[model samples]
Every structure is written in structure tokens, then in C-alpha cells.
Target: MSALLSLRSVSVNFGRGEKALRVVDGVSFDIDVGGTLGLVGESGSGKSVTSLAVLRLIPERLGWSTRGRIEFEGQNLLDLPADKMPEIRGRDIAMIFQEPMSSLNPVMTIGSQISEALFLHGWPNRAKRHARVVEMLRLVGIPDPEGRLGAYPHQFSGGMRQRVMIAMALACSPKLLIADEATTALDVTIQAQVLELMKKIRSDTGTAILMISHDLGVIADICDRVVVMYSGRVVEVADIRSLLQRPAHPYTRGLLESVPRKGQERERLYQVPGSVPMAGSVRQGCPFRARCSVAVDKCAVKMPPMFRFAEDQRAACWVSAEQSNAPVIEDLK
Candidate 1:
């Protein structure tokens, strides 16, 4: 399948001059048409920032600047005129933010919030917009959808609120959905329901999804491909099966081992030593070298380029590269 969304060497920086921080460093990946790709990493790994950069949502006044290419459906989003972005944001690409309560307007009825996107995207007929809102609510499994149209956001439960957010996002039938920690605030049951809802939406609409989360379990449940990031840079990319079976990057391995297993309730979960380094703190070499058990001298001298282990798998780790005997495909540094 062709790429629905492609990010090439995308970098996001905050502040300027000597004090500037490179929060998202030269990250590159692709989401195939109608495919699900998961961006998995810790909280400070720049997952959220990268998603925001794609939509040009970064606050320029706050000294945030984005570089590199973000291509969606053959158009480079970075090169698009600023005024043209709003035209594409909801119609072509929509985002489900982490917090539904904060994202949804408390004062406005759920119906109005869902209809807002449709109206902005040129669905000027009020009756049609209301119908679309009801349709979307029903599609997301909201019971008594027509009756709840007038309900405020606070009137709904957390899962219901998230479903409303999803309904609103999909109201315009966007080609790509960027869900950043979409299920993080929900309980396991609700998270599973939301994931299933997303899968159903994709199956029903053929919409490609970019699922961003720190939980590999969530990623495993929903993503076909996984991109493992560390300290703002992508360290590994592989099919979900390959990644779960044999993670190429140390960071990826660490993340998998840290997850609690079904029968390991009594066992202490393995932990990746040390927290993620502050953004831009690792000025040279592999950002994960300090915590990596297998770090070599080469890891300290310079960052390793992505080594192709297979057609669908790549890792930016010297040890993995050496062991696999794969040629360097791309230098991210």
C-alpha cells in the first residue's frame, strides 16, 4: 500500500539560540493507506510534540519551530501556505487529543461540538449537520445518541466523553486520524472499547490511523507497525510481530520487558535503568547509551544510522547492526 502520511527527518525545536531544545530529532516514518502505525515511547519521548507538528499546531509565539517534511497524500504539509492548513486540518486529517474533558467545550452541548467541525468544513446545512452529529454518535456506540445531543460534556462518563471526541473527529471523514494518548485516561475495559471502536472505524471508513501511546500493550492491540522512540529520536521501526518477537533496539527491548506479564503478578517487573534523558541533554552519540547495557565505544562517538534487518525492520543501534550484519540504510543524525 502507498503511504497515506510520510514524515521525513521531521524535527521540532523549542526556544532559540544556545538555550534551544531539540525535542523531536530527525524523526522519520510512514503510515500506509488504511494502516495503523503506533508511536511508542515514554512521556518525554516527543511523541505528542511530533503529532502536533504534523498539523502545524505548535505555538510559534512560544518559540516552537518545526523543520523537515510532512507529506500527506502527495502534498508536503510543511510547505503548504499557513492559511491553507485550516482547510486541511479537519477535512483531511483530524486529531483526538489526550484529554477529552479539556478538549471538549463544557458549555456547548455535545451535538454543537460535533457539528462545529462539519460547519467549519463547509457543511452549512444545519439539519444535515445535526443528522451527521447523530449519525457519528450512533456510530461511536453512544446510546440514545439523538437524545444526548443536548447533553453537556460533563454529563457524560470518561469513556463516553472520549467517544464524543472520536465522533467529533470523524464527523468530517478525515483520511488520517492522529490519536495521541487517546485511551490513556480510560480504564482497561474502556481503553479496549475505544481501541475496538478505532479499529471498527478504520475498517468501516478505510481511514489510516497514527496511534501514539507509551503503552506497548495498547500498541500491540491496535498497530500493524511500531516505531520505538528514545530521547526524541526514532530508535527502531518494525512490524508489530517482529518487534514483539525480537526487538532490535535495546530501548525497544527494555520497553517490552518492562511490561507486566499475565503470570508475573508476583514477580517484580523489569525496569529500564534510568529515566529518559531531558530533551537535548544528550548532545552527542546515542541518546540511550547511558542506560543501554550493551553500549559500545561506537555508541559514545556518534549516533548509529538505521540498519535494515529486514525489508520491514530497522534499528539505530550499533550492537543490533553488528549482530544482524545489515547495511546502514539511513543516518538520522
Candidate 2:
């Protein structure tokens, strides 16, 4: 199957002089048409930055560039002309950001905000834009689209605001949707509802999705494939079942172990030791070696190459070639 979106060894950096920093380093992945690929990592792992680079949404002063190509719909996005980017943004790709309150205009009516996407993208008629606004709201499951259209952002609840954001993002029926921590602010129930809605939208429209989140459970539930990120790079990539059942990277294992399970009794939750190295402080080795229990002299001395587990699964770890022999915590204790 051909990829609808592909990132080949992409790198994104920021700052200048002594402050120069590389936030995303040599990361690559591909998402197939109508497939969902989850980018999972702890905070500050460059997942969001990677997504922003794909959308050309990174801050201008930050000085972001990709040494590699971001191919979407058979075109290299990095080489797309500035004038053409806007057409690609709303028509070919869309994003649902983490914060609705900040992303949504404070004074604009919910319906009008969605309509702006249509207008900017050359909808060309007030009647068609109005119809699209209402259709999109209904598509995202907002209640009473006609009445909601007149209501401002402040009038809607957090979940409703997010729905409006989703409605706006889908207003153009983009082929790929990039969701950056889209559920973080919502309560669990609402998060589940939004995710279900996204699944429904995907089924109905055949839209490919790239979902970025720090929550492993969210990814497990919604994504077909998963990519584990660590310190600005991809550490593991696998289908959902294999990833959750038999993660290969030590960082991936740590993430799985860190999540609390039902009826489990332990003194404290397992935590990945040490902080993510500051953007420029990363060394020439496995980025997680500072926290990996399985780290050896080789792990600390050089970055591991990606080892294939199967056709659809791969991980960046020397141990990925063999079953991990590292001692478990129970054995250590």
C-alpha cells in the first residue's frame, strides 16, 4: 500500500548562536491512506514539533527546516511554493490542536469561525459557506447546528469548543488530519466521545489521521499503528497489537510499564528515570540510555539502528534483534 503521507529522515531545529537547538532529529515514518498512525511520547519529546513542521505551522522566528522530504499525496511538501501551501493546508491537510480556547477566536461565533476556513480556501459563495458550516457541525455531532452557529466561543463548553475546532478542521474534507494532543484538556468521557467521533469521520470520509498524544491508552484505543518517540527521535514503530503486547525499545517498555493498571498493587508506579536531555544537550548514543535499565556500553556509545521485527514493525535498539534479557524489577528487588 502506498503512503498518503511520508516523512523521510526529517529534522527540525530552532534558535541561533549559543541557543541553537535541535528539537526533532532524523525522524521518519509513513501513514497509509485512511490509516491512523499515533505518535506517542512523554512531554518534550518533539512529537508536536514534528507535526508542526509537517503543517508548516512552526513559528517563523524559530528557523525550522527539514533536510528530508515530507511527501504527501505524492508531492514533496518541503518543496511546495509558499503560495501553494495555503491550498494544501486546509484542502489537503488539517490539524486539530490541543487547546480549543486559544485556537478558537474569543469573539467569533462558533459557526463563523468554521466558515472562515471555507472562505479562505475559496468557497466563493455565502450560501455554500453557510451550508458547509452547518453540515460540518452536524458531521462532528454538535447539537443544533443552526442555533450553535450564532453562539460565540465563550458560550460553548470546553467539549463543544473542541467540537467546533474539529468541525472547522473537517470543513474542507482534507485528506489527512493531524491531531496534536487533541484530547488532553477534556474529561475522559468527552475524550472518548471525541475519539469515537473522529473514528466515525475517518470511516465516512476515508481520511488518514496522524494523532500525537502523550497518553498511551488513547493511542492503544484509537490508533492502528504506533510510533514511540524519545528525545526528538523515533524509537519504535509497530502495529497496535504488537506494540502494546511486545514493545521492543526500552523506552517503549518503560512507557507501557508506567501506566497504572486496574487492581494492581505496587508501592509506586514505575517511572522512566532521568529527565529528557535539554534540546542541545543530547549526546551521541541511545537518547534513553540514561533511563534504560538494559543500557550497555554500546548503548551509551552509539545511536542504535532501526531493526525490523516484521514487515510492519521496527525499532531503534540493538536489543530489538533479540528478545530482551534484561532483568525485571521483581528480579532486581
Candidate 3:
């Protein structure tokens, strides 16, 4: 399958000159058409920032800037005129932000909020837009869709609000859906329901999904391919099965081990030693070296290029690159 969205050497920085901080550095990946890709990492790993950059939503007034190519359907989004972005943002690519409460307008009725997207994207007939809004609410499992149309955001529970957000995002049938930490605020049962809803939506609409989360379990539940990130850089990329069974980068391994297993309820869960370093703090070398157990001298001197371990697996680690039986691909630097 061809790529639906491709990010090449995409870097996002905050501030200017000597004090600039690189929050997302040299990240490259692809989401194939109708496929699900997960961007997994801990907080401060730049997962959210990367997704925001895709939509050109970063606040430029605050000294934010993004570099590198973001291509959708063979068009470089970075090169597109600023005024042209709004047209593509809602109709072609829609995002489900992390917090539904903050993302939604508390004062607006649910129906009006959803219909706004349809209206902005050319659903001119008021009757048709209302019908579509009702259909979307029903599609997302909301009951009494028509009756609830006048309900304010404060009237709905957290899960229902999130479902409304999804309804609004999918109202126009976007080709790509960027869900950033969509399930984080929900309880376990609600989280599972949301994931299942997303899966059903993808299957029914054939929309490619970019699932971003700090939970590997969530990623494992939905993603076909996983991109593991540490600090501001991507450390590993692989098929879900390969990454879970044999993680190449130490950071990836640590993330997997930290997840509590089904039968290990009595045992204390393993934790990755130390916290993620602040972005841009490590000017040279691997950002994970301080936390990695297997770091060598080379790890401290410079960052390792991505090494190929299989047809679909790659990792950026000196040990993995040097020790792998498969030929290393050092051109990713």
C-alpha cells in the first residue's frame, strides 16, 4: 500500500537562536493508506507536538517553528500557503485532541458543534447538516441523538463528550484521523470502548489512523506498526509483533517491560530507571544513554543511525547496529 501521510526529518523547535529548544528532531515515518500507526513514548517524548505539527497547529506567536517535510497525498504540507491549510485541516485530515473537555466548546450545543464542521466543509443545507449530525451521533453510539442535540457539553459525561468529539471529527469523513491520547482520560472500560469504536470506524470508513499514546497496551490494541520515541527522537520502528517480541532499542525494551502483565499482579511492575531527559538538553550523542543499561562508549560520542534488523524493523542504537546479523542501514541519520 502507498503511504497516506509521510513525515521526513520533521523537527519542531521552541524559542530562537542559542536558547532554542528542539522538541521533535529528525522524526520520519509513514502511515499507509487504511492502516493504523502508533507513536508510542512517555510524556515529554514529543508525541503530541509531532501530531500538532502535522496539522500546522503549533502556536507560532510563542516562538514555535517546524522544519522538514510533511506530505499528504504527495503534496508537501510545509510548502502549502498558510491560508490553504484550513481547507485541508477539517475535510482531509481531522484530529481528536487529547482532552475533549478543553477541545470542545462548553457553551455550545452538541448539535451545533458537530454541524459547524459540516457547514465549514460545504454542507450547505441546514436540514442535511442536521441529518448528518444525527447520523454521526448514532454512529458514535450516542442514544437519543435528536433529543440530545440541544444538550450542552456540561450535560454529558466524560466518555460521551469524547464520543461527541469523535463524531465531530468524522462528520466530514476525513481520509486521515489523528487521535492524540484520545483514551487517556477515560476509565479502563471506557478506554476499551473508545478503542473498539475507533477500530469499527476505521473498518467502516477505511480511514487511516495515527494513534498516539504513552501506553504500549493501547498501541498494541490498535496499531499495525509502532514507532518508539525517546526524548525528542525516534528510537525504533517495527511491526507490532516484532517490536513486542523482540524490541531492538533499549528504550523500546524498557517500555515493554514496564507494562504490567496479566498474571504478574502480585509482582511489582518494572520501571525504566530515571526519567526522560528534558528536550534539547542532550546536545550530542544518544539521549537515552544515561538511562540505558547497555550503552557503550560509542553511544556517548554520537547518535547511532537507524539499523535494519528485518524487512520492517529498525532501531537507532549502537549495540543493535553493530551486533545485528542483518545488514545495517546507516543512511537514516
Candidate 4:
């Protein structure tokens, strides 16, 4: 099957001069139609920026792709004319941000907001557009679509606002949806509901999803495949089951260990030692070298190429190929 979205060596850098930062570095992955790919990492791992770059939503003056290609549906989206990019964005690709409160307009009525896409895409008449808006709301499982139309974003709770965002994103039935921490702000119960709704949408509409989140549990529930990012690079990529069962990279392993699980009782949660290094402070060799308990002299001197574990699984770590020799430490100091 052809990939709905593919990023070949995509990189996004911001600013220039002494303070310049490379937020996303040489990352590459693909999402097939009707497939869900979860991007998992700590904050500042470049997941959000990478998604923004793919959507051509990176800030104009502050950021640009220093290199690589963003191909969507066999076309290089990066090569498209600027004016025409917006047409592709709303119709063929859509995004649900982390914060719906800030992402939605406070001044606009929810109906007007959802209808905007249909209007822009030329849904024919105002009556048709109104009907489309109500249909979208219903499709997203919102109650009382007729009454909710006049409501402002602030009138709805956080979960309701997020539902509006999802309804808007799917108004035109986009082929690929980029959900950047879509459920992060909601309560656990609501988060589960939203996630289930997304899964239902994907299955029913056959829309591909690039779901970005730091929550492994969420990913395990929804994603068919997973990509683990560390300091702007992909540390590991595999089938969801494979990754959860046997993560190869030390960073990936660290992430799994950090999460609480059923039947597992521990006083304190495990955390990867040291924080993600500041973008500009990154030096030569492996970006995770400083935090990796398994790092060796070679790990500090040379960056590892992505080594294949299976046809679909890969990890950028020298030790993964020789797990017996991989370091086994109780904790990092």
C-alpha cells in the first residue's frame, strides 16, 4: 500500500545567529491511509515542530526546512505554490492542536467556525453549508447540533471545544489528520472518549492519522505503529506491539519504564536521567548519548545509523544489535 504521507529526511530549523535552534533534525517516517502512526517523546523532542513542518504551518520568518522532502499522496507538498498550499491543507490535510481553547476563535460562533471550511471549499449554497455543519457535528457525536451552532468556543467545556476542532478538521473529510497532542488537556475519561471517537472516525472514514503524544498508554491503544523521538531524531520505529514488548533503544526503553502499568507496583516511577538537551547545545555523535545509561566510548564518538530489527522495525542505537552486551544499570546518577 502507498503511504498517505512520507517525510524523507525532513528537518526544521528556526532563526539564525548564536541563538539559532534546530528543532527537528533529519527525521523520516510515513503514514499509510487508514493507518495511525504515533509519535512518542518527551517535550522538546521535536514531534510537534515536525508535524507543523509537514503541514507547511511552520512560522514564516522564524523557521524553514533546512533540508528534505514532504511528500503527500505522491506529490511533494514542499514544492507547491504558497497560495495553493492552503487549499491542500484544509481539504486534504488537517490538524487538531493540543489546546482547543487557544486554537479556536473566541469571537466566532461554533457553527460559523465549522462552516468556514465548507464555505472556502465552495459547498455551493449557504443552506448546504449549514446542513454540512450540522452533519459534521453529529458525525463527531456532538449533541444538539442545531442549538450548539450559535455557541461560542468559550461557552463549551474543554472537551466540547476539542470535539469542535475535530468536527472542523473532518468537515471536508481530509485524507490525513495531524493530531498534535489532541487529548492532552482533557480529563482521563474524556480523553478516552475522544480517543475512541478518533478511532471510530479513522475506521469509518478511512482517514490516516499522525497522532503525536507523550502518553505511551494512549499510543498503545490507538496506533498501529510507533515512532520514538529523542532530541529531534527518531530513536526507534516499530509495530506498536513489537515496541511495547521489546523496545530496542535505551531511550525507548526508558520511556516504557517511566509509565505506570497494571499489575506493576513500584514506589517511584522510573525517569530517563537528564533532560532533553537544549537544541543549540547539541554536540557531535548521538544526541541521546548524555542520557543513555548504555552509552559507550563509541556511542560518544559516532552517531549510529538506523539498524534494522525487522522489516518494519528499526532503532538508531549500536547496542540494540548486541543486546547481551547492552548496559543493564539500576539507575542513572
CA lDDT of every candidate: 0.94, 0.86, 0.93, 0.87
Ten consecutive residues with minimal summed lDDT in candidate 2? 324-333
Root-mean-square deviation (CA) per prediction: 1.2, 5.1, 1.1, 4.6
lDDT of 3: 0.93
Please report, as a residue range, the 10-residue window in candidate 3 with the lowest summed lDDT: 324-333
**Each prediction's TM-score against the native?**
0.98, 0.94, 0.98, 0.95
Q: Number of clashes in every candidate structure?
A: 0, 0, 0, 0
Q: Tens-digit lDDT track for model 1 on 1-333? A: 889899999999999989989999999999999999999999899999999999999998999999999999989999999999999999999999999768899899999999999999999999999999999999999999999999999999999999999999999999999999999999999999999999999999999999999999999999999999888999999999999998899999999999988866655789999999987789899999999999999999998889998889999999989998989984533
Report the error of model 2 at residue 37, Å: 0.5
Clashing pairs in 1: none
lDDT of 3 by residue, 1-333 (tens): 899999999999999999999999999999999999999999999999999999999998899999999999999999999999999998999999889778889889999999999999999999999999999999999999999999999999889999999999999999999999999999899999999999999999999999999999999999999999889999999999999999999999999999988877655778999999998789889999999999999889998888888889998899877777656675653
Q: Residue 26 in candidate 4 has what lDDT?
A: 75
Model 2 global lDDT (CA atoms, 0 to 1):
0.86
Residue 226 Cα positional deviation in candidate 3, in Å, after optimal superposition: 0.6
